[model samples]
Target chain A: MHPAGSLIIFTVLSGLGFGLLAFLGAGVVLPLGWEAFVWFAAGYALAGGGLLASVFHLGHPERALLAFTQWRTSWLSREAVLAVAALGMMAPYAAGSVFFAQPLPVFGAIAAVLCLATVIATSMIYATIRAVPRWHHWTTPAVFLAAALAGGALLAGQLRLAGGLFAVLAVALALHWQAGDRRWRDAESTPGSATGLGRIGRVRLFERPHTGANYITREMVHVVGRRHSAKLRLIALVGGAVLPAMLLALMPASLLAAGAALGLHLVGILAARWLFFAEAEHVVGLYYGRAAA
Target chain B: MTDLPETTDKKLGLVIDLDICVGCHACVTSCKEWNSQGYGAPLADADAYGPAPEGAFLNRVHSFEVTSEDGPPQLVHFPRSCLHCEDAPCVTVCPTGASHKRAEDGIVLVEESMCIGCGLCAWACPYGAREMDPAEQVMKKCTLCVDRIYNENLPPEDREPSCVRACPTGARHFGDLGDASSAVSQLVAARDGFDLMPEQGTKPVNKYLPPRERDRATAAPALEPVGEAGGFLGWLDRALSRL
Candidate 1:
């Protein structure tokens, strides 16, 4: 739960891009015009830039090409493979929409499905983690999906859609926050379970394995200051869902207002994503003698 | 390719006895010495002589104090390494096919050459088992001493994990757990060895023997007086009986 900057940017921005792509592909906006071109361009740029930024996280970026080959089992692999397929399908959809000013139902349909699938796959990368108790829940995907759609709707200038999605996102976020906070303190694994000492009463750490931090401690045992996390969670709620909903509701057709909403929503989503990473409690932390986890 | 085998022929793993392990870190040291120049990457240290040393280790020993219902607190030395689970989540989560389970022996391993160093395998492991080697930029874990155990160059008696062989108290054990009649399995059955974090459902092959409680009531014998039933002895005995 290091909350690496690259991942935060990648998940949030790509989520927005994919959400916009889905809306545009379904012709939910309108009859097709120059604005549609701008929307598609911006969407792809966000998605593509986010994807490109992800490479920096890898120590051996050249070998990242191999990650796409394991889509059968790995969620990360599935994300890699589905991202490529979705992006590839978006090429013709973008070109035809921008050049001919005609929305092809076939390309749009394929791109729409792929875009949604890609987002689900991205969320599954963390949601499927059995070791991270906070993330291992049904609400994880629901929150991710709702947040992406809400962000995408705002970015695409669909005020009504953004408003509705924000309401849904707010509900999802509330549910996630309630469940997440409860599970953070009450993880099923205990100190006894961690070391297999439950048969005896009151097991406690007398000594740690080492004085200095190892990979497990350094990577898995990240602590978020409670006050800071609470503040950030509030910011995520207000900026991500509420502020955008307010802005879009008051100034429905204003391009400037839409831009402002997207900016505020981005900041909020970034903070939410950061919290998502920071709050994740890996089960190994229990072994480190932080038994409260 | 990341799929684990339907069944491994022999589930070879370790059975560490918590009752006998004295937290001496013999296994930790021996594992480090033998693996420093291993078949895989060297167990490298970045700042050995510095104020803080950051290094990667496959096995570590953690000591804990647990108080039972009947007695005072006791120190429990727990050695943690890769469990080499039957349903190894690390193998399934690897984006690359580098992290794998050996079909023959059920030893979970990482192919250094193919590893991308993403650390996803480490994230998937709940036991704090998979450790990333910062020097090699790949995940490293207990291979159950695959190099030494199968090496014909060594003597038959020495054909075991360095940790198991180095333990002075013989608390560390290594054998085929798949066989019901194996020495390790029998020991597990006899000692009522239990799995760590059974809720995780990894079905880990490695088991830990809980510390046996010492009997305080029958431990010492009663002392007899040299002169019975006389003078001060009689008066003291009558007073003690009255109290």
Candidate 2:
């Protein structure tokens, strides 16, 4: 879990983009004239940008097309396929809703469902990493889904919807943080369990396998100190959720408040996502003397 | 293709004896030499001749001291590589059909030509078994010497993994693990060999033999003075002087 910049951007941006599309597709927001096109265009842009950013970190970016073909098993593949389907369906729905001013009820409904599924699939890509106990819990997906919905509501300029989702999102974030912090405190895997030497006794590393960091060490052994984690957690809470919620409450009084809330929320999520990657303890880290087991 | 087989015909794997491994890296070097020139992409190194050198290696040996309160501390050398699990998550997580487990032999391998090198397979592997080669933009790992083990051109005696063939102490053993009557299987049963991470439940084919304990009575202890007869000039002191 290197906390790669590209991947962070991909996850957060795609989540918001897809979330916005879900709202629009379901006819929750009925924008007139050019506003409808703007909403759809912005959603597509963010979603597509996140996807392109994801490819940036791949060793073989040219072969990404083949990724869609493995949806039968790979969650990453399923996400890609669903994202494309969501975008495809959104195209016609947007045309009908924006150009003809007649929302295709059936198409909109299907597109909305696809958008939500795409976001869930994307969340599952990280949530299913069993080696990282913090991310493996059901809380991971709960936080991700809530973040998408809340972010989507805010960006779509639906104050009441955003207000409601902000409360739900707050609860999800608190739960995710509590569970993740507990996991960090009570790491069940030790070098003994990781190496299967627990039957002998408590296994502690006497020597590391290498002098310098190797691929496993660099990729998986992310050690965020307790104090630093506390600070970041505070920032994620105040900025990602609290500040946005407060700003949205005042949005009806001032148009500038919406933009401020959206901006603060995005930055807050960046910090949160960074913590997400930084805090995950991959089991391989046990071999490096970086994780419990 | 991503799904594992319900049953494989023969489980080909290795059994590493922790007792005999001397921390010598002969297996690691031999693996690098053989695999760099054969069957797959070369195990490339970055800044190999520079101040800080980093590279990809298939087999690695680690030495650690395991201490017990009642006895003297023991230094154990652990040789690590792929275990070729029966239900390898590495194979299941590959987005392309590149990573697969052989239904015939239960050996997991990556088809480099089809690999997208997204590194998901590496993340899925709990053993830290997968290696990504930056040169080919592909994932490389211990193939169990897939090329030589089945090569008809090679001599029958040479038909083994490079690590097993090059082990100086013969600590690494290879055989058909699927057969209950196989020599390796019998060795495992006799030695009480165990899987590295049974809790992960990947059902690794490879097993490790725990080190045998030294008998306290047979172990050498510091020589005590032979009473008032000869405090500094004891038989043990004389014997040491002779050496």
For residues A20-109, write the lDDT of model 1, one tens digit per residue: 888777667643567767888888888888888887677667788889877888998998888888888877777777787776778788
lDDT of model 1 at position A57: 76
State which docking tier applies to candidate 1. Answer: medium
Where does candidate 1 stray beyond 4 Å? Answer: A30-37, B217-243
lDDT of each: 0.86, 0.83
- List runs of model 2 lying over 4 Å from the truth: A184-187, A224-227, A250-253, A291-293, B217-243
What would the per-residue lDDT of candidate 2 be over residues A1-293, giving only the tens digit for each residue?
Answer: 78887888889999999999999988888775589989998999998889988886788888888888778888988998999999999888899878888878788889999999998998888887777778877888888898899999888878767867876777888899889878756766667766666656556676776676667777777664544888888788778888788777755745687778788788888888998888787887777665462
Q: Chain B, model 1, TM-score against the native?
A: 0.88
Question: Model 2, range B113-209, lDDT digits (tens) per residue?
Answer: 8888888888888888887885787888998999989999999989999999999899999999999999999999999998876766678999998
What is candidate 2's CAPRI-style docking category based on DockQ?
medium
Output the lDDT of residue B109, model 1: 92
- Measured against the true two-chain complex, the DockQ scores of the candidates, in the order shown, are 0.67, 0.52
Give the TM-score (vs. native) of candidate 1: 0.93
